[model samples]
Target chain A: MTELVKVKNLHKSFGTLDVLKGINLTVEAGETVVLLGSSGSGKSTLLRCINFMETPTEGRVYLNGEAVGDDVNGKMRYKEADLCKLRSRIGMVFQHFNLFPHMSVLQNVMEGQITVLGRRQEEAKDKSMAQLQRVGLAEKASEYPSRLSGGQKQRVAIARALAMDPEVMLFDEVTSALDPELVGEVLKTMRQLAEEGMTMICVTHELGFAYHVANRVLFLNQGEIHEEGQPQALLKTPKTQRMREFLDGHALFKLPE
Target chain B: MEWNFAPVLGSMDILLLGLLNTLKVTGLALLFGVPLGLGLALSRLSQMRILSMVAAFIIEFFRTTPPLVQLFWFFFAFPILFGVNMTPFTTAIVTFSIQSSAFFAEIFRSGIQSIDKGQWEGSKAIGMTRNQTLRRVILPQAVKRMIPAFMERSIELLKTTTLVSTIAYTDLMYQANDIAQRTFRPLEVYTVIAVIYFLLIFVFSQLSIVVERRLAKSGEGTVH
Candidate 1:
């Protein structure tokens, strides 16, 4: 399998607080990597850095073997235009749906396609509709986000991101803000995407999703990867004490075999 | 002192002309100010330190100083300082345009800043350039929320345009002053002009209320 994303010595700092410390990772095409960590473990930051939403304080990110930013005198220098182009190829869904409130669902999905990709309006609308249909939100295309349920809004957000036809999708706790029952639909959509061979990196506390859908699971703790392996092994037999304790904290980690 | 609106009514043509001039200045100032305010707001919000500082400085300078002083400076002092002829009409337009723009800029900045940070992240994630994101995503939402504040500022601008009267511009107030002197009926003339101002401003307030209701009904301006 060809590597689609690579993170080498990735370090991120907010002022004096270091969030991500010397991390390296690689995801192959069609691979689904689930990131598991507690709050403040830098899971969201790591996902953000992958798309340059949060620039890494140190190190580099590569997509398809191409560096996201140019190296200048041992430091990464990014032009806005270049970063924008790179970001367009990496879809990200936020914890809060973040659908444009001013626009209807279809418009939200079509905005980036028409504006960023410069697709014709008619073409963008058709593509956006298809993405909405894939997420099972095609019927609600004409409705505003404020009128939709949390799950429906999230699905529209996912459609908005997917309308770009990105190479890899980054999900930053996409279901974290949903109602208990609403999370299932969103997870189902994500599972369908994974089944269809879309490369995905998800930061989630939902162990059930990680166990069932993920090809690999990485346990992150305090800015470092504490443990990582195939989901069946790592979720069941954590190598480190911290990973074991972390798993112990999550009661939902166990599922019927 | 007996009440006699005869003199005030006699100068109706001149007062109407003055009212028209008042609207002209207010409308022109709004035309120039809204776009200028948007520019200043964008500049102030820009990441470039110097540009934002410069924009901030301009906005503060115009907002802090009195509009009357600004009008006086533009009308009396500008011609001498800049070696250019200044007319009362042009002075009214220029002074209020930049002055109201300072206030409008703040309204615009607050409106734009009030949008959720997630909107910016979402737009960025989709690969939109900053300008594209702002024009497509941010401004469309911000403009709606700003309508009420914008209407308030516009009404303020209309009242502030009356300051042009001190410089001998024939606005509603100036014409009232002229009619009061000629007719020797200060009470009647001033009261008539006050009523006209009240009617004009009241109409605008009602219009703003209607627009706000429409926006609310349409499920907008509630994104926060």
Candidate 2:
């Protein structure tokens, strides 16, 4: 399989605190890689670094083999203009589902297409409608985001990202903030996208969704990939004490008797 | 002595003209000031050090100094510096616009900055550049938050137009002074002008409340 995303020796630090330390990763095209870690293990930071949302203090990122951020004097320097273009190819959905409160749900989905992609208004509307339909939110297009539940808002956010026609999607704890009952709808939408072969990197603690949808599970511990493998093997028989302990803490990680 | 508003009644035409001029100056100042302040606030919040510094200097200079002093300087000192004379009316517009802009800029900066950082991050995640994020997502919300502050500043600007009287610009207060001098009755003249100012300001304040309610009921910039 062709490698769609490659990170070499990624290191991110905020001030003196090291967040992601000397990491290397690769994801093939159409792969769904679920990053699992407890809080502050830097799963979110790693996901953010992939898109230059939080620029790595030291690293090289290759998206579809094209270098993201500039290689200047052996250091990465991203000009805002270049970053903006690069970001368009990689969609990200936030935990908060930060839809533009001033816009209707349809406008929220259409904004990026018209503004960044430079599509015509009519074409953008059509594409946005299709995306909204995919997420089962087409009927709510005219409603404001504030009028929707957390699940519906997240669906709209997903639709907004999908309308950009990005090559890869990064889901940052997409359903972590949702109510338990509302989580299933968002996960179902994500499952549909996965089935359609959309490349995805998800940072999430929902073992059920990860178990069902993830092609690979990457367990991060203390800013490093402590263990990683296919969902059935690695989760069923954790190779390391850290993984075992982590699984013990999250009872959902228990294998069937 | 006896009190009478007979002189104010006689000079109704001049007072009306002056009131019109006051409205003109206030309206023009608001039209120019609100946009200028938005620009200044953006500059102040910008990452570029030079833009932030320049905006800081301008905002502090205009905000700290008195509007009356600014009017006097624009009227008296500007001609000497530029080798061109300005009418008192022109001077009043320039001074108040600049001064009101400084105040409005503060309001706008706070309003924009107060927006949740997640909103900005959300726009960025959708691949919007900073300018697009601000224009489409941030400013539309910020502008709503700024309206009340804007209305307050406008009312202050309305009262401030009276200062133009010092330059003989013949605003409401200026015409009041003229009528007072003509009839030599300061008590009645000042009383009439005070009543007029109160009524005008009271009406505007009530109107602003109605506007605020409308904006709240129908979300700002929420179409369809």
Chain A alone, TM-score per model: 0.98, 0.98
Where model 1 places Cα greater than 4 Å from the true spot, the runs are B216-224
> Per-residue CA lDDT of candidate 1, range B1-224, in tens?
68998888989999999999999999999999999999999999999999999999999999999999999999889999999998999999999999989998999899898899989998999999889989999998898888988998899999998899999999999999999988889999999999999999999999988988898997666322
- lDDT for every model? 0.93, 0.91
Per residue, candidate 2 scores C-alpha lDDT tens digits across B1-224 of 99887777888899899899999999999899988998999999999999999999999999999898899999999999999879998898899889999998999888888788999898888789999999888988988877877887899999999999999998999999999989998899889889999999999999988888787787653210
Q: Candidate 2, DockQ to 2 decimals?
A: 0.77
Q: What is the lDDT of residue A79 in candidate 2?
A: 91
Off by over 4 Å in 2: A252-254, B216-224
lDDT of 2 at A228: 96
Give the Cα error of residue A170 in candidate 2, in Å. 0.4
- TM-score for chain B considered on its own, for each of the candidates: 0.96, 0.94
Against the correct fold, how does model 1 do in TM-score? 0.98
